[model samples]
Target: MTSSIPSAVTVPSNNVVPSTSTTTEPSTSAEPVAVAVEDSSNLDNDLLDILGIDPTTDKKYGKDLHKDLSVRLQHWTTVGLDKDLKKELKDRYLTPGNCKLIDPPILNAEMKAAISDINVKRDKAIEAKQKVLTSAIVCLGEAITLLLPSKDKDTNLIKLLMDAIRIICECQHSD
Candidate 1:
């Protein structure tokens, strides 16, 4: 997520003094301005940048940020945000009592729909598996009867045997 331009501040520098000086140099326009280099607090500044808030201009930005976060935490307590970092960021950028947080309705609805779809698919899979079990049992019974080498094969009883098989299969197939 690269930004078009980086966030940075152009801090005004003060004239620096030399360490070894027997005689103080007279204040003149000929001397070049010397600024002390200091490390910027990147994390704090970044959080402010993300929230579209500037900390330097506003005196109450830190306090406002804290208050806003506290109110948000009271309302939506399920984000599970990093405690220290969240507070730090909030303190840096949030305006006091700001109520601009986006609601999670969309996410919640999508999750519910996904759960419903999964349940429906699971039910269909179970039904299909039950059908396969019954089909296998019926096929096995038919194969065994057909392979029987008995000479006194009661052809008339075959009808009754088939009806019994059907009943057995129906019972086994019942979910």
Candidate 2:
């Protein structure tokens, strides 16, 4: 006589059963069977999902990802981020001592100050370059005017123009 056994054991949806089991019959032992546990690393998984980054293909963890995450943390409401998620982002992800993407890890108030400082410096640099270029163009225009065979071409002015042209040529070479 054959004792009939169920081919597949019906466990709860939360529980996982391994597919490599060779036994057709259920165990009669009093001890509990080992089951696969769900991955409880929700924070990492949530970050990956939100960033739309595939861990398998993308090995890069650079400033872009850090900046994106930082922006998300700051502007949580823009993405309709849940309160619990916001809490997790602030508490777990936005720590200064955490990921050092930017030197000293600019975040929150520091990030704001750093950005302002950068903008100010960038603007100043652009203004200074513009001034130099304007000066150079003006000098070139004056040199061209001196070259035009005009009646009032002073020897001193012609010498100055030659010097200006030499300086401009040097600047171009340096650049």
Candidate 3:
């Protein structure tokens, strides 16, 4: 008696690959045990199935599907999840007579005001630094202009001034 194992396993239309193996048991009869392959060779189809996305007619299929899924997930998290949580909270904790919604507008406005103040301070600091840089540049330019025309000007002094200006300019004004 000879037994042959299939070289190429053909996956059916349903994307299930079944492999049968004979196992010897304590009882005289041998039984063929069937094992199923969950995923097929077609990786793209498998991935699409895993993501719960259907193939669309759109040219940008991957991008559109990704965007659609993102929107769906976002909506579920923000609205559906929040609604479920609120319902659970109401069911578990608060009664109808004692229930009062927290005023979020007051907290939101305070946060906005604080952020605006910080932004204003940041803008002011930037403007001050810019003014200082402008003043330094003007002073350097005036010193260079004056020294170039003077007959008694020291070369070493001019070189030192240039080096100072270069150092200052190299240190950028931004944070």
Candidate 4:
């Protein structure tokens, strides 16, 4: 006797069988999956600018900037910044000492007084520089205008004119 199997198998439409094998383990590919990461470095730069940090070759100043940034980040975080900002700051700067720094609030009266004193000193220095520059410009302009056309041929007057011209050229070049 010869036996043969059917070419196709069919099941009742209402009695379908589920697949016997199922995947239970997560993927283990070595390639890194892409994720959207929030950039906190730009926030660091903005904080530095807001705190009036100047570019310096001194390592001490760099340390000071880092300390100031850390303190400010802690203070702002405690004072209820936007949720996203707070998260970014915490991710970037939160530390045991940073938490303590904000406890007394950096914006207190003593800090305010110190900042005001620094501002006054800076303004005075700027005023002094401006006065010196203005005097120099006025002196050069007056000397140039006072020279007679006949004196233009004189070597001494020509030297003085050249000196004034040099000052003007230096200022332009500096700008």
Off by over 4 Å in 4: 1-116, 162-175
> Which regions of candidate 2 deviate over 4 angstroms?
1-131, 143-147
Model 2 poorest 10 in a row by lDDT = 97-106
Per-candidate clashes come to 0, 0, 0, 0
lDDT of 3 at 135: 46
Order the numbered candidates by lDDT, best leading: 3, 2, 1, 4
Per-model RMSD to reference: 29.4, 23.5, 23.9, 26.0
Q: Residues 1-175, candidate 2: write the lDDT tens digits.
A: 1112343344433333453246655555443344334343655767767878556776756455477778876675466657675345344423123312212211356545667777756656654443443445454654666566877768786776767756755553443
Alpha-carbon runs more than 4 Å astray in model 3: 1-116, 172-175
Q: Tens-digit lDDT track for model 4 on 40-128?
A: 35468777678674556334532344777888878865884676854554454332342232221124466557677777566566544
lDDT of each: 0.48, 0.50, 0.51, 0.47
lDDT of 3 by residue, 1-175 (tens): 1124434343332333233435332222243333443454546866867877445643463334477888987887677646566455334432123312210112245555767777766656765444444445545655776899899989998998898767655542332
Query: TM-score, each model?
Result: 0.22, 0.23, 0.30, 0.25
Top-lDDT structure, candidate number: 3
Q: Candidate 1 or 3, higher TM-score?
A: 3
Instruction: Summarize candidate 1's per-residue lDDT along 1-175 as a digit string, tens digits.
Output: 1112233232222334441223455334543333233345545766757877556767743334477778887665567557685455444433223322211112345554767777766656765444443444445455546746668777667665676666655654454
Q: Best-fitting candidate, measured by TM-score?
A: 3
What is the Å distance of residue 104 in model 3 from its true position?
Answer: 39
